[model samples]
Target chain A: MLFDFEIQGGDFATAGNASSQIKKILKQLNVDHRDIKRIVVALYEAEVNVVAHAFGGKISAEINTTEVRIRLVDEGPGIPDIELAMQQGYSTASPEVREMGFGAGMGLPNMKKNTDEMHITSVVDEGTTVELIFFLNQTPPNH
Target chain B: MIVKEIVEKLNLTVHSGEAGLSREITGGYTSDLLSDVMGNCDAGKIWITLQTHKNVMAIASLKDIAAVILIKDLKPETDMAAQSETEEIPVLGTSLPAFELTGQLYELLK
Candidate 1:
């Protein structure tokens, strides 16, 4: 199955729509409970990154019998230093955003921790793209 | 323990999502940052936070959190409450602050 979702920047009200929808679909497909949790966490962080930093972005997810791959591409001021941005305490979110309990610098690291394989690419002043993969075959939901 | 028992123990107000009052509560987490909760909170745990936005509900649903406890008597926004209803994740409120509420909750759960 393939799912595509568009994210609007600064739209906190609707930010998690895509993640929520994807969760339902994953459940319907009988994805393992553990895998669904990991995938949903990674996907929600990616969606929030777009809403917090980019003007807009698109998420493409491909789910097969064995694994799920997600790609998030955003248009905005891309990250100049991916390594620093991945740090546990690093964040560039606005004060207002922070007040709402976001932008604590754990987003990328969490995404990486939840996925089996993850890659990130960004260009300053241009855009950013992130790829996350989760292997669903290793441990079934009930395992 | 289930959410309704905690509600009785802590004197928390059921702001919305009464349908979820019976959900089991395995644990509790307190964080103002959404990412912290997302990365750290376990499923079926109750989330204790001060955020009163709609995104909080989104995170609760995504993480499969049993319920949300709003601090300092903070109330959920209109739409946030609506989402709680739709998602069937109760958004409970309390006049006690985060620290005190969490302490009592931890004691009960422990």
Candidate 2:
């Protein structure tokens, strides 16, 4: 099944709705709980970025028996430095966003941590797109 | 400890889901940031924060938090309360400031 949602930027009240809906769908689809949790976390983080950082965005999900793919696209000022943004404690979130308990610079890192694979594309004046994939058939590797 | 005791000790008002007061909470995490709460908080911990948004309930649902206490007497909106019911997580309100409530809870749990 496929699901898509438009994520409005700066809409703190509805920020996680897309992820929550995805989580419900995954649960009903009988996706593994661990994998579902990871996907939900990654989706929520990306959703938050779209709201807090992007001008606005859309999230789309494709689900199959073997895997799930989530795409987040936003028309906002693109990241000036992807490497710095990927650092665990680096953030450009405003004080208001931080006050709401986010912007600890963990969003992207957490997204990367939770998903099986992640891809990011951006342009300075244009926008950013983040794609995350979770495989249903593979267990997370043990350390 | 039961949520009721935590509420009483903190002198918080029950915003919704009074029945959840009977539930046991093994630990507590106090934060306004949903991301930290989600990334670090253990399942079933009582979450205390000053944030009274609907998204707080969403985070609680995702993290499986035992319940949410909105510190500083911050009352959640009606929509937020409704969302809590939908998520089956209780939302409690407290007049105590974040620091005071955390201190009290720490002493009680200690």
**Which lDDT values do the candidates have, in the order given?**
0.93, 0.86
Candidate 2: stretches off by over 4 Å: A140-143, B1-5, B8-11, B19-24, B97-100, B103-110
> What's the TM-score of candidate 1 when only chain A is evaluated?
0.96
Tens digit of per-residue lDDT, candidate 1, span B1-110: 99999999898899999999999999999998899899889999999998999999999999989999999979999999999999999999999998999999999999
Candidate 2 lDDT by residue in tens digits, A7-122: 99899888889988998898898988878878888889899999999889988899999999999999999999999999989999999888777899988988998888999999
Question: What's the lDDT for candidate 1?
Answer: 0.93
Q: Give the distance in Å from residue A49's predicted Cα in candidate 1 to where it truly belongs.
A: 0.1
Name the TM-score of candidate 1. Answer: 0.96
Clashing pairs in 2: A101-B33, B73-B94
Docking outcome class, model 2? medium
